[model samples]
Target: MSTCGGEGPEEREREWEDAAEAVAYDSSTWPPPVVAVCGPGNSGKSAFSRLLLNTLLGRYKKVAYLDTDVGQPEFTPPGFVSLHVLEEQTKDLTMLYLRPPKRCFFFGDVGAHKNPKLLLSYIFGLYDYFLQELYCFNETDDPKKSAIPLVINTSGWVKGIGLHVLSEILRYVSPSIVIRLRTTSEGKNLPDGAFWLDVREGDSRVNIIEIRASQNSPRHLLVKKEARMIRDLRLVAYFRQCLPRDFSVFSYDDLVQGFAAIEPFQLPLSKIQVIDLHCQISDDAQHDFLAGTIVGLGSSKCVSLSTECPFPWCIGLGFIKAVNIPGNFILLITPASRRLLANVDIIFRSCIVAPTCLLQLQVSDEVDDITDRLRDL
Candidate 1:
């Protein structure tokens, strides 16, 4: 695990290394360790989680990651709580490279403050999915065989409702180990020792390890401007997949131009249902509101207009390039495979808006040619 910039790399290494060793090699523990990393904003929680994940990869063939930080998720884009099974070590943890998760739910907002309960429900659902499908019991006596360990990376918002949400998560998950990163500013740090546990609980058994947050890396301590830029870059990177694998983009402008010219999928309005998670839109306004916005592409056996409908299994994201009311179809740009798109019957609109640059691009006249060549499904 490399440090961005920090005074005590050796001490940080020792702290996480010891935790990793316990999780990977400790046979006394029956089930594998469920480690939850929590802290306030810019407290190196993500970095530590990545380091711990890489360390565990040395011992286990696969490690499960429950990413609850929708604002800046580890494996998926913003506004998603996902569960990912990582089989190989991440070469560069610093890079925000998007990877498909085994299971995920789109919360439709960057922050959990909008709908904390909904967010937690999604997190719990993903965790349950992991426990049922990916978590190994390790009944075999062979030393080589072991249960897959889980690393939970929590959101940076650790105050007020965020704190309550964290406590609820701790209560539900009851992880074997809780690693709390200590920020330099006392005001920003989480409560000391088992903070999530109530004082009335009488000495919680959950092991708590506290380490100083890395100070050297400016990126780790993201300001509002940098954070916004990173999110935008991530969105652009995700949409860039729509281009040909052999296509060469010389710069961001070139990439924007590529997206502007690319042919978008045309889906009949009757074939898909739209649900806005944040606000209500009138039937007449649905098409206009969805145009030029990022939407969660999902598939469900049954669809409901109610916001409380059982969360749909989101396949991926799509950008609504246009709303062809005359044609009774929508022009969408997404990188999801054709097979996955075939089953998409629900479109979830959240606050996850497309980057202004991509949305502002004027569709080239070539788009009509491309659209004409590609048949509407």
Candidate 2:
């Protein structure tokens, strides 16, 4: 475990002043500036966001997709961003977050790692995350800021105060290109903008990423261990009017030098559609991320859930206990998701989503008695 092989002359002038503060692009050109693209969950960060938005706007430039990839945001292309449910009630059962509606759009739903803000006077409860970093570095309501490059699609649940609020929003609204994609199984890499450190356990910048702490890689290996686990990630430099999003925080091994270019990449079944949720899985690498298709939610049956795998704990790592929970609410299936819901009009296009809309009041009359006992059986 020996690194820092060579460097002096003030550590190569602080590594060329951290690579010119990582390509500062305070927006100037045309609608081509804010490039954010982060990584971690299922780590393909949306197939590197469709390979960097069809390789920088080739698929016709209106490119928006702002799900901000919050927690576990799925659905892509279909007119994007809609669901904004947030209900709370502990003991009597009622909890759901599905966020992302304002503070700069794209939030369809999901937010539950809860209590984790390093300090600086609780950054005033992140007033809706500093109101989307004040509309992503407001340069007159986003003149695309430093130039139409707004690429933020993060959320793979990082620690140390959300990686120092993503490095104080890249030093406050300064992004021209901070593309950091990471998906590792066992590969040694890092290059696309490098500072994703999360070192601990007798740390020593652990060579920037000895991160084999599996279940689906989470911590940094070293970009200077993000200033000591960002000291609990200091919520917001003791809060004072917030303003920050400059851009540049990476560590999917600093940008791919290993991890075999992110394995598990196979979704092209014409864009992969298989939602047969009669889940009672016995995963051999999760039979293609839980096959798909199946519905019923009055009393929401089908419960195996061994600790987790509801899909957004950032792609259910902890390897999901080899999955096969006999916990009840039965819905088990496998002959290929029962032949991909063997069509009952494609299982009536599937519907059973009560993780919380406050269960629309404990399941609106039990989902109309489970949709009239699933249409009289």
Candidate 3:
């Protein structure tokens, strides 16, 4: 592989143009403008979102970015709807690194269609926190006081129930600017008018901006490589922080070696309750079910087994590296802060699963042997 140099002049020019568009629509009102980027898959929604965030940083002290796309998240790992505050510009959005979000809720599933109602509740809760706590106006009399601008990035799924979920999110957010991207295919675009207007009749308060994708737009090729592969790489990149920042772990083989050699933290099963977010299974099966599974570490005071209770706040993601059923302990590997671990009261087993390729181990043997199973733990 060849090492690339700095950004070319053409790339700089296009970024400037995209930033100018965002600057033009910035509301002159007292509060910072709220912007939402929506479009179908590979339509440059993430591209446009990064551009807008860069522009907003020039105007506001900090920009609040709410990522609703769990499959291909911008700032954090997959299976989370998170809010992040950006104080500096992001030169490259493609590079996956570890950064703690200001607030996050684990959806577990990649697509919202699995549980739309629960997804909406998480989005609303984040918005409420932004409004009640992070709002810049009315809370302070200092000159530096100002509401932080918001930028929302939606998922690529834009048809059927996915479209409805987007509409519900728009209704709840009521953003000041809606940047909708369209591709060459007309059928893939959203409805002609505002899809969320039905929620509030005769309310066209939201500003709509239509953007057409260029030939050079970034696209994810799911056929050549499965989307799950990218997700696994992301998880590896995040957990690789278990190693020193100076040491590099680039490939799947390196990750497997690193994970296998590292010592895992043992959590007492009696102190924390384990609940499957998607379904209820027999107690006998929970042990094997949780082994090698990605789980959400929750810190809320109320950890209910029933689904009626709202999903608790997820502090971070953890993988059950090993389950010692008879010993009444589980070994977990996570990047969560040590302070957050003290408050963790329950572990929610999410639908998110790490790919097998990242878990496969390489065994050194001089003699020929036949084995179908690869040892992961």
Q: Could you say which candidate leads in lDDT?
A: 1
Q: Could you give candidate 3's per-residue lDDT for residues 88-164 as a string of tens digits?
A: 98877565555688888888888887778888888888877777557657756764445788889998889998898
The alpha-carbon lDDT assigned to residue 361 of candidate 2 equals: 18
Residue 321 of model 1, lDDT score: 78
TM-score of each: 0.87, 0.24, 0.84
By TM-score rank, best first, the candidates go 1, 3, 2
Residue 99 error, candidate 3, Å:
2.1
In lDDT terms, how accurate is model 1? Answer: 0.79
lDDT of each: 0.79, 0.29, 0.72
State the TM-score for model 3.
Answer: 0.84
* Candidate 1, run of 10 with poorest lDDT: 301-310
Clashes of 2: 46
- lDDT tens digits by residue: candidate 1, 97-130: 6888887888888898878888888887777776
lDDT by residue (tens digit), candidate 2, 1-377: 11122234455334323322332322343434444455444444544444444334432233333444333443321112221211221222122122233212211123322322211111222222333433343467554322223345555444455555555444343444555533344342233333543333232211121111112354456523542232212211111011123322254332222211112211122222223332334334333332232221111122212221221101110000011122111122111222222321211112212111111112234324434564676
C-alpha lDDT of residue 208 in model 3:
74
